[model samples]
Target: MTANNELFILSASHTREKLKQLRRTHQFFCPQCKEELQLRIGEIVVPHFAHKKDSNCPQLFSDGESKEHLIGKQQLYCFFENKGLTVQLEPFIKNLSQRPDLLVTTKNEQYAIEFQCSNIPIEVVQARTKGYLNASIVPIWLLKTPNFKQQKPTRIQLVQISPFRQQFITRHPQHGSTLLTYNPTTAKFIYFSHLLFIHGYRFIAKVQQLPIAHQYFPFLHLKEPTKEEFTHYWRFHLHIRQRFLRQRFYLSRKGVQDLLLKGCYGARMRLDQLPLFIGLPVRNAQYIDVYIAEWQATLLFFLQDCQISILQVDDEVIAIFILNNPDYFQDERGKDAILHYILLLKKLGVRSIHSSTKEAIILQLLHSEFLAKCYEN
Candidate 1:
């Protein structure tokens, strides 16, 4: 008989009445709830079992149920063992410690294969692979057929492998075949026979092959940080610094100014210092020196967002001051000034006041004093 016909016969023959007869001969428990089970097959759908009314039964399985999954796992184990591969079968790794369906090991390699019959969340699979990689073990995820169909095994299209350097295999449900490849390399999926004898079989099976056009580091596909994200990052940094060192000063605006100066004076400085400032628009360089000259004005404006309290002066609330411009302070000194300013604000409830020239000179003069104050009781 055809595969579909065979499935129909198997499903139809195991009707509620037939299951009832079997249960009468041998009592059975609900796979989900572990309560006493009663056969309750539908005339149209496949046969199923229900539990007693008081049972706390959840939906066991959507496709073939637990019994079917057990059978499938057993059959798969047999198939692999028959091929001379040492298969560690069913609940491999033990005690819910991220056990895979099968753990295969040879003289030179080891692999963890997850047989996913139902469609599970991709991220869950990815996380599992990540955990496996941390343990120095490689993972191969396999999606099995829901029921034994006569059609070809689903085409296993490899997804991603963990450690970004391992092998992975994925069997597409519809096509009934597996795609196998490794990580950190742009290798194509060859026939299963071709892969069986390859070195690092375990690691090579879990990773997806990159296309020829893609470069090694593909973070270019990641979304650009939004303005709001940049703001949050700056706030987070401020909070972290405050918690660790007891200081309060807005780093975000300063960071922007630093970036602006770097872009404006790129030719005069080394590229290593470029990242000292980030998030400034490349085109804003021309106006940067002008903005730096008006540091106090910018600080007054940004103070509102920083949530620092200010005394009202000339119809404006102003509390803090910007001591130096990006050109005045080297990167290390700028960092030191920022930390010192935060500690001073936290302790004295007063902000530092400085002209642009004093701001420029204070770093060299106050470096030792600031460090002493920071460490003093």
Candidate 2:
């Protein structure tokens, strides 16, 4: 929030001459708390306001703020207001019990924009987002220090992802779920879509950048990956798997790596021999408890124990794996991923998929010429 108490609410830019005309007798107050503001104009600084010494507004609390953040908020206010839309600056929503840095309303739509500059706990972030969503107001968070890099990078500098940052992710109708961030200084938004977790918290994403002024949907999916692009991606994950043996990724507890490696070694499984099936880029793999190599190796050992091959893969067997590997996936997503891989293997004539729905593409593909060769072979 700006300290421009002398200026009007929602419109903070007032010339010193204009504010000087109001004299020392001008009446102003905090927008949220309504505490009286004292107008102070100086020869050096721009005309602004200072809350009276006795004022105690709960909203005044701040970990800290930056000049860029202040200017960005002002620029955004002007950006929306210039569009002839109804906009308010630092307005407190009574019902939601939160004050967004800026709020914009267009007849049928209301949006709360938080110019997020500092990192906060995930719980606090999710709570705020949930509150706004429950109140039927869309919350949009704009990150000031976002990671932007080149070449569909596997990872940016996200040492840790705050809960607030995780809320940036959302799914689309086609391509996949994506994460969004904005750079207020550049007036641009970044879209990180089609995410695939490779190892630990790192991911390979299709990144796109566009100006905030563009009249387009931010969540629109991008094009599918070319065969060569996909091949390169799988190879990248293979490298990540190799790195897992060297202990290069995040595993919460100490000596857990020893348990995972020793468990696989005792099964007479060579980590290098594991197939891509082990670390295949299922979108929900991010929810798995272990990194790629650990879980994938376990799946391979389980398959070997059952004496199963691609031709004999059974859905029941997959369910058994889920039952046995309680730490594999977060929730029902593990089941969905199992089904996806099973369906893919069935299409390749290496396994059989028994989806009972006629409208399902997997079932239809099974009956097509693609699966006919599988049956013949």
- Number of the predicted model whose lDDT against the real structure is largest: 2
Instruction: Tell me the deviation in Å of residue 356 in model 1.
Output: 61
Model 2 residue 15 lDDT? Answer: 64
- Considering summed lDDT, which 10 consecutive residues are worst modelled in model 2? 368-377
Estimate the lDDT of model 2. 0.59
Residues 171-219, candidate 2: write the lDDT tens digits: 5545555666667667776766555555555665556666767724322
Separate clash counts for every candidate: 22, 1
TM per candidate comes to 0.27, 0.70
Q: After superposition, which runs of candidate 2 have C-alpha atoms over 4 Å from their true positions?
A: 1-27, 38-50, 58-64, 147-164, 213-232, 245-270, 310-316, 326-332, 351-377
Each prediction's whole-model lDDT (CA): 0.37, 0.59
- On the 0 to 100 scale, the lDDT of residue 148 in model 1 is 18
